[model samples]
Target: MENLFFNHGKDKLLWETEDKILLAISGGVDSMVLLRLMEKLALKETIFLVVAHVNHKLRQESDEEEAYLRAYCKRKGIPFYSIQWQQATSFGMEEAARNFRYNFFQEVMEQTACNKLMTAHHGDDQAETLIMKLARGGSLNSHIGIQVRQPFSNGELIRPLLQFSKEDIRKWAAEQSLVFFEDQTNEDTHVQRNRIRKWVVPELKKENARLLAHAQQFSQQLEWAEALISEQMEKEFQTHVKKQAESWQIEGDWLMALPENQQYFFLSYFFKKSLSELQVGAKEEQLLQLLRLLKKEKAQWQVAFSNEWFFKKSYQQFSLEKNKQVTDEHHVLHYDEGVYLNDREWIGILKNVELDKVPAELEQIGWSTFRQDFPKDLAKEFFLRRRRDGERLHLTKNLTKKVSRYFIDNKVMNAKRATAWVLTDSKNNIYGLLPFTLSYLSIMEETDKIHYVLLYKYRE
Candidate 1:
């Protein structure tokens, strides 16, 4: 035990002599052995140790386990903390417990000013994880299973006992006359992981006695492959993905031009960003379908995920945005200066300025300069709304043109047209396009009495 601690714990600088460490103890043999080892280390090094245990209250012995561990820590003169699960749910109990445990560990570590968090995931856990990954057809990233060390929330998570087998930990605990509590639910074959740990791993060990070692070797190989692939994917992401103000934009054509594996990684990179636990294997088809859509010209589509995340492909540029609560509905409001159109995502204000003073930049798409004519009845009946189909606007005194044809001729993408808003009156006389243009009634000469109605468009 000392050799292992010195070689891996001390030599690797997993924790400094003066550093405070937090251990996640569950009153199991593995965690108990880890606690004992940490105690031995603390005797030689001036380090602080804090123990945290979570009581899920699922078993009758949960309270007993917590009491025993707390008493042990009390006798050892170490600080111990325990939290009970308040909310209970029958479905997804394993996942829920894991999330609750980790969140508690994070909170405790923060409160104690601990620099490192220690866990007791040993060789058996790694073997079971690998087996599950293989069964689920996991990607190269999943092949790494549980790492010895990783970055936790604002600190480091160190699994020092990963190199030790479950049997080895139990044997060491017995040799040292250490006491620990066992949760009998571990023997419940109803749980998939318990079944795998008891039967699948033991059966595999028959073929190779050192199955854990072989699995570690395979993981190392996968790690090497992933390192190379990850470097290339990062470069591709930097080159193609761009961060917009309220969304992320990716160059669709450039992304699709890469190799299929690189493309998968490129999409997976963003997927893992928003959906951290998303399994790429299950959603690969959806990604492929999106890629296919991107290849088509004028393709405008969106896929909504949890937490309001949406992937929108507009022509050759793809954007990932969080969908706002505001829907794309036609909103009609009485004409009032400085009115904000929440549904249209724009602010309407009538600014009084010289007609010739309008910036030439305002002529660009998504910005417009309109001159408002104050007819006594027009001002009273005027309203703001989203553009409607078959609406016509007069380009000349005698010539009227359909607004839809105007959009088509102007080469506006269908995606943008769908959510486009316009300003008009109750009599259906269009005064201005929300973000595109000003009608002839509004576009004036230098001497025209300019209400100078303008819309400042903003992303929702």
Candidate 2:
């Protein structure tokens, strides 16, 4: 009994001594047990108990569930909150309901002056999720199971009831003679989770007789394993995430050399922990594919997870960053030998005219020393910057046409062509334009050369 409560009741420590709790009650067995436990434990405390419910309007019985939950909370002297969403006649009911629920939880927490929110996720729920992931082929993150004290990247959201098993909760509810409304939709097999709950666990249990216990213990062990790995990786990750003048980059060579499993673990971990502030999870196939292919020297791969949310692999570097929106900014640069722009992370060089003097010797050199090759005869240099105002450039060497017209002459995307910057002469005429257009022919020339160097920028 001591182990049961200590193991299961450990989550209560997260609650503030004098703070309020905004519990998400579904009027189901799981939430009912949780509510009753809170009532029994916090009955004498000076904490406020607020009930937050999402009326998804999924079934005819949902209204009754809501009413019952309201009445139960009222009887216990706890505050109650309920919200109803009129969903459209579309699919993805679970996802829509989840969205509604989470948004409503945020609203209720804000309105009630509570920052802590608790859910009714138990060990059985965790086990079911693991088995489902296994059936579909588990990845490195699938084994994370339910988070005992989950938080958003900014430490805003949290889950507390993840350590206890549903059986333990059910037994506790029985001991207290607690009653909660039954959700008829839970019995409907239309949902994948329901099917797993009805058939998968029972069948597995019948085969092993102790499979449930094993799974629970195994999941705890996996949590421990994940903790040890994460602790070690954090030390290494601190050294690897470096910053540059313009962007962030993690090394491909060092990242590729890690052990296979650790490679998968750290890749996903590093991206979620260090890169985009959005949530990330690994599909085993996708993780394996990236590890196998990210080694190619110059090959590129790109995928858009969502609008403006994209990841790309180019020139042996994996770039996870926002999409660049081009702008119409006028720029000028004087004819110069060598120039540097912190934003472009490049050193620009132009030497005296020599048709056969290609810039081969500048390849794969350090940023500090690359500009030493600049010829002193044409030493005049000027700096360039990005802007979004009206700007124009010449299309040809004759300086007779605007850069926009040149892009139009070549049928380039107007949105993309608008962002072209140019180098100018001392008299404010176009000498050459920076590369943004597809057919701009901006490659480094033998006598006229420019080098873009990727420095160890900070990780996103």
Candidate 3:
């Protein structure tokens, strides 16, 4: 551990900042080594340490680990924070425990005014994760392995030790004589990772002595592939993602034009953002199918990713949105109910109201309630659908401009224009396209109350 700290410990690399770091110490070998390294490096001067431990409360010895951590922190004169989670009785114990830990970490960080959090997930753990994900038929994103730097609530979560192997961590712990509690369940085959660690890994290692090394190589290749694909997808989004007068949109035509691999990565990026905001995962196939929902045929579709956000596939665009309880950066309002995007920017709503008897489903489309006082002539068409090729507006009945071209001329982002909902009638006539003007479109009849909702509920 002394040599490791002198040579390449996490303390020097990521802790140079004046951030109070909440170290997630499970009393496992890796975590103990992390605590010891911090001590050895004397990083506490620059980085305040909060030894945060969570008792999963699964095994009887779980609480014991918590006790040991508390005692160790007290002996070291370090402040310690702890949480006990009872929610693991649910089937998704790992996920549930993780969520609880993060929530607690955020709370503690805020209370301590901490700037970052650190975890000791070493390289071998990364390899195991890659193998596990592949064994479960992983996607490109899954193979990316846990990110080196992940976003936490207000600060960042740093995993500097991930570059090292489990053997490295063990050697460090042994050299430092670090005290840590062993969770016997780690050896249980009932857990998938344990089974892989025991039966699968050993057999593979026997068949090919460098299997771990090979897995490491695969992980690196996947990382590079992910980065290259992500770059291409970003360029595509740069070309396609746009903002119209109010609503945001993405060009389906442009997306479809990308190479198949690019399509998957771009769609994955969009859906993963939505999923992260909504707190959902592992729905690559489901989300890929959902991308079609962004075509011109549908004005809006909602998808649930747990409770953080609702994915909106509307107006030829896909986006992640938060619940009413969350703050809106654009509106800067609590935005609980429906909101007519202030300053004519956009309209986002959370209710299930139907406008003009448009056969509304729950939260699929925020139908605009046309006021009886509003002139029907003001609506080029009464039906609500995303803009399409056959769609056109009669500027003077003598000539027409493609809504797509009109949007471009209007300086609306191509991506946003593709997804922006345009009002139309059952006769397939253009009603009023949602404009990104500084104010309501002059076309919006003063007597009419346009109902628009930005947040869409997740589709079943």
Candidate 4:
């Protein structure tokens, strides 16, 4: 066992004498056995080792376990770092604890200048993970289970014990006379992993003695398949997808042109590569519904992707974007006092402006800039506000058009329509739609007097 472990470290991990490794120790049997093996390797190869422990403060023995590990590390003359998870969560405690654990491990790695983070995920854990993922249903990526090694933070996360099962670790620990804590929570079947570990895995192992090895082999095979599929998907993505700031845009026709299966694969690949932080799930139903919506006859449609994001189909263009949560803007305008319409837009009223000799800045204010003349008798105090529902604009002396209808006629995107401002009076009389159209009442003719000029400025 020792020879196999040493060879695995030197060959598979490619560990050198100068390489500093941060070990995530939980005081459990699996991690304790890992620490013992790493210590043996350090003695033989002179490799640097740092011990990091996270005290979840969930179990009653957590404090004791942390103190025991700290003392053990000190006795071995090894650097020890530990953190306590002070924030208690009511639900999803297991996942929350796992996140806190790895986060502390990363901080320790950074502080100690370690280039590798090691965890003790064994073959049994891998089998359980695969079973849980398969039963729960997810994309092929999820079924790949815990990886033996992957990039984490500034370095790599390595699970050297993945090739060994739990029984093997326990047996080796016994032979070495190592003292390790047994987490009682592992016996509680209330947790899905614990439940599967107690009943489902053992039954499967009975049918096939090499269940652990087979599970690991399946994971490696799936990883290879995913790589091949991803290579092709990336090429297709570059050809069909357009990235705009934080959002992603794709041609609807291009997506619908692909085979139905490829469409699902492409969408899955796009979400995983581009918007991974959003944690969008690859549910078959959700993807099928999106595909159906794309095939509909409607020119434009939108559906919520998540609470903070949405998928929009505008004409022939499909996009995934963050929901723009804009508060209704209503600012009272004063002469020469500029008010911000949005983050980059500024609007103000200028008095006594010559129509022929507009300010140089106003002259260069792009096409979205509104510089219309309004009769001084229009209102005593004019304000700028976002377009309200059921509002109408005076297009002619006897013609009126719904504000929503005007936006549709002009083909303005839903996002743009939300930010469009309306120039109005205290009595809610619409003066004009800034940067788009002027109300017939606000338009100045050669016969009508122009006293106030509404100036709009947009900063790039």
Candidate 5:
């Protein structure tokens, strides 16, 4: 037990003498054994021990279990917390109960000023979780099993007993003569976890005598693999992605250029960063489809997620944001040979052009003609920025329309409209092209007139 504690609980130890711990006890054998071990080690003298139990009130014995835990804590001279789940929900009963239980545990942790919340998830539980997640079809992240330490909101959740198997816990409890409650609901085969615990695990253990040990080892290896992948993914993200106040973006071509595994890994990482959880079931498959579609160059595209998150691809940039009213954010850039906009993503290129000597290939290269007699003065006042409301472009002298109306008329998506660019003179006139309108400032007629043509390209 000491070896397992030192090996698995090193990160959970806040301090030598003043650490406060909140134990989530269910009056079950595993938690009872954990309590006995802590008592034997005299941890209560060095650190404050608080036991918390949540009664779902689903079973008739739940109240009795809570009472038993309370009595035990009182005898040990430790604080005990109990909360009842009085609300009713129709679906996902187990998930709802687990969420409520952890929430109440977190509340107790906060109220008592505890640094860590401990659980009794042992090796069997870890194996069962991995199997369930695999059956539910999750990525490698789901295969990581139960984490020994994970960030819970602001504090940490530590499960030190995960290194020990269920048999080990039971033996410890028996040696200490510990009394624990048995929830009869655990025997109901209708529950998937109970079915797995009663039938699947026992059969597997018969085949491999040390199945629990193998499962624990596999879980640790998966966790290490996840850590390594995350480290590499962070490096890639730092090199190619940028997080803004209202949105997150990645350079399209750079992201697409990576290997397929890295692409999936980074996209999964981004999804978690944005939504705080992995997209599961059919939604995860849809997200993968969206990621594939984003690799292509589409004029206007958008994908919506279940949690009010939106994905948009415009030109050569991919962006993700929460569903909210997005206001225009303006960024200014001067005209030069190559000027970057929006954190060096979109680039503006300027070159001297003579109307007579303009190459026909220039049109093929996406160069928009910006003919002006005072080319140098226009260049000095030229700046590229995001579109604003009430802005209009002169499509022709007689054809003028608001930019917002233009988007509406052309079926431009709201996601694309947020980051679309508009070129204007110092007076804020619209010289729109492409995502912006196709109208030029003016036509070129004079052969001797010196002009400057500007075009935009996404930097890879």
Candidate 6:
């Protein structure tokens, strides 16, 4: 057991004499055995070891466990850091405790300048995790179970005991006569992991005595397969996906053109990359629904990806972004002044101005400036607002066209059609479509009276 632990640190982890490791000890047998193994390694290599413990304060024995571990660390002349989780939630106690524990470990690592944080997750834990994930169902990546090493905080989280089983650690602890705290809560069958550990694992071991070894092998194999898939997925992602400030954009046509399985893989990869911290990925039902949405005749649609995020398809582009409420706001604007239509768009009117006399700022290449003459007698107070459904623009005294039909006929993108402002008078007369087109009535020349030159600008 000592040899396996030592070689994993030396060969797999590439541990050097100067390397500092922060060990997350839970006062359980598994972590106690890991602490002993690390102690032995340190004696021979002069490596620095720091012990970090989280007193979850969930059970009556929590204080006793913390005291026991702290005394042991002091006796061993090792640095120890501990924190109490005082803000435990009533619900999701397990997940909350785990998060709190790791956060404390990260803090300890930073304080000690440690480059590696070691945990005591063993093969049995790995098997249980694999079974739980398989039963719950998630992306293929989740099936890989607990990794041997993964990036955490500023360094790496190394699980050296993954190659060892629970029995192996218990056996070593007995031989060494190591003292550790036993949390009686682990025996509660109501807990899913405890249930699996007590019943399912033994049953699996009955079928194959080397169940832990098999589970570890399966995890390694899945990791290798996922690594290969990720390599290709990255290449495809780089080629097709675009990262905007607050969202990720993908070419809908390119995604739909791929084989169905590839499409699923691509989306899974995309979600994993975008929400890596959340550990949320696209499930089969969600992916199938998204595929159906993508293939539909509608040019634009959106669905909730999760509580905090959404999947939006606009024309040929698909985007993943946070949930945002689309507001139908009206802005009353004055001449020579601009109002922000949106975060990235500004709209204003320039009255009585010729094309050649347009302000230099408005003459920038990207500004979508338009010029049109509105009747001098029209209401001075013009409002900018989103196009109303079935709204029409009077082109002339006898010709009027539906604004929606005009947008369709002009091949206006769904995004622009949704956000474009309709310039209307106080009487709800549509005179112009902001930067796109002006109604024919707006272009009609009044020979005997003056007209207002309405200039619109839309910056990116």
lDDT of 2 by residue, 1-460 (tens): 2245434544446665676778888988788877766675576556677889888787788898889888877887899999888974578877878887888888877777876787887766777888877777665555656655655322245454555666777777777777777777778898788998888877876798666567767777788887887887887677775544423456766776777777777766666564445554434566667677655554456655555645566544555555677544433333332323334334344333431232333333542332223222232543344422344554444445555556656654432343444544344443344453311222244764443321111111
Which ten residues in a row are the worst by lDDT in model 6? 350-359
lDDT of 3 by residue, 41-142 (tens): 564456567888988887899878888888888998889999888676558677777788888989999998878888888766766787789888757767
Q: Candidate 3 or 5, higher lDDT?
A: 5
Task: Compose the digit string of candidate 1's lDDT tens values, residues 1-460.
Answer: 6478657887678888788999999998988888989898898889999999999998898999999999999999999999999777989988999999999999999999998999998888989988888887745676677877789976899988777788888888899988888888899999888999999999998998899887776766777777787787777667777775556778877875777666677787666554554422226566777667655675467876656667887666677766655364555444344444553354444445433343344445764333344322244545665566688877776787888988877766655676566667666778666567657765556555535445454443
Model 4: CA > 4 A from native: 55-71, 83-90, 227-247, 272-285, 306-308, 322-460
Model 1 misplaced stretches (Cα beyond 4 Å): 86-88, 134-144, 218-239, 274-285, 295-298, 306-308, 322-384, 390-410, 419-460
Question: lDDT of candidate 4?
Answer: 0.83
Which predicted model would earn the best lDDT?
Answer: 4
Q: After superposing candidate 5, which stretches have Cα over 4 Å from the reference?
A: 1-15, 43-45, 153-155, 244-246, 275-282, 290-302, 306-310, 321-460
| Candidate 6 segments exceeding 4 Å error | 58-62, 87-89, 245-247, 275-285, 306-309, 321-353, 371-384, 395-399, 409-414, 425-427, 443-454
Worst 10 residues of 3 by lDDT: 326-335
Model 3 stretches with alpha carbons more than 4 Å out? 9-12, 17-19, 43-46, 207-217, 242-257, 270-282, 286-460
lDDT of 4 by residue, 1-460 (tens): 7788888777885477778999999999899999999998888886899999988888999999999999999999989999999987989988888888887888888888999988999999999999999998877776888887888988899989888999999999999999999899889899999999999999999999999999999998988888888999999999998887668888878887887789878988887776677686446667778878766788788877678778888777788988887787588875545566555687767665444343455445352565666566566677888888899999899999999999889877777788777888888989878668788878766765547677776642
Ranking by TM-score: 6, 1, 4, 5, 2, 3
For candidate 4, the TM-score is: 0.73
> Clashing residue pairs in candidate 4, if any?
none
RMSD of every prediction: 5.7, 10.5, 13.3, 5.3, 9.8, 3.8
Task: Choose 1 or 2, whichever is better by TM-score.
Answer: 1
Pick by TM-score: which candidate is best? Answer: 6
The sequence of per-residue lDDT tens digits that candidate 6 reaches over residues 1-460 is 9987887777885467788999999999999998999898888997899999998888999999999888888998999999998998878889989888888888888888999999999999999999998889867777898988889888899888988888889999999999988889899998999998899989999999988889989989999989999999999999998887667888878886887788878888887788775565566788778877766788778877678777887677788876655578888877555566655565555445434554566666767756566555456678888898989987778889999988887767665677778888888888788678887767645483654566666664
Stronger candidate by lDDT (1 vs 6): 6
Is 2 or 5 the stronger prediction by lDDT? 5
lDDT of each: 0.74, 0.60, 0.62, 0.83, 0.71, 0.82
Residue-by-residue lDDT tens digits, candidate 5, 71-93: 87898898999999997476788
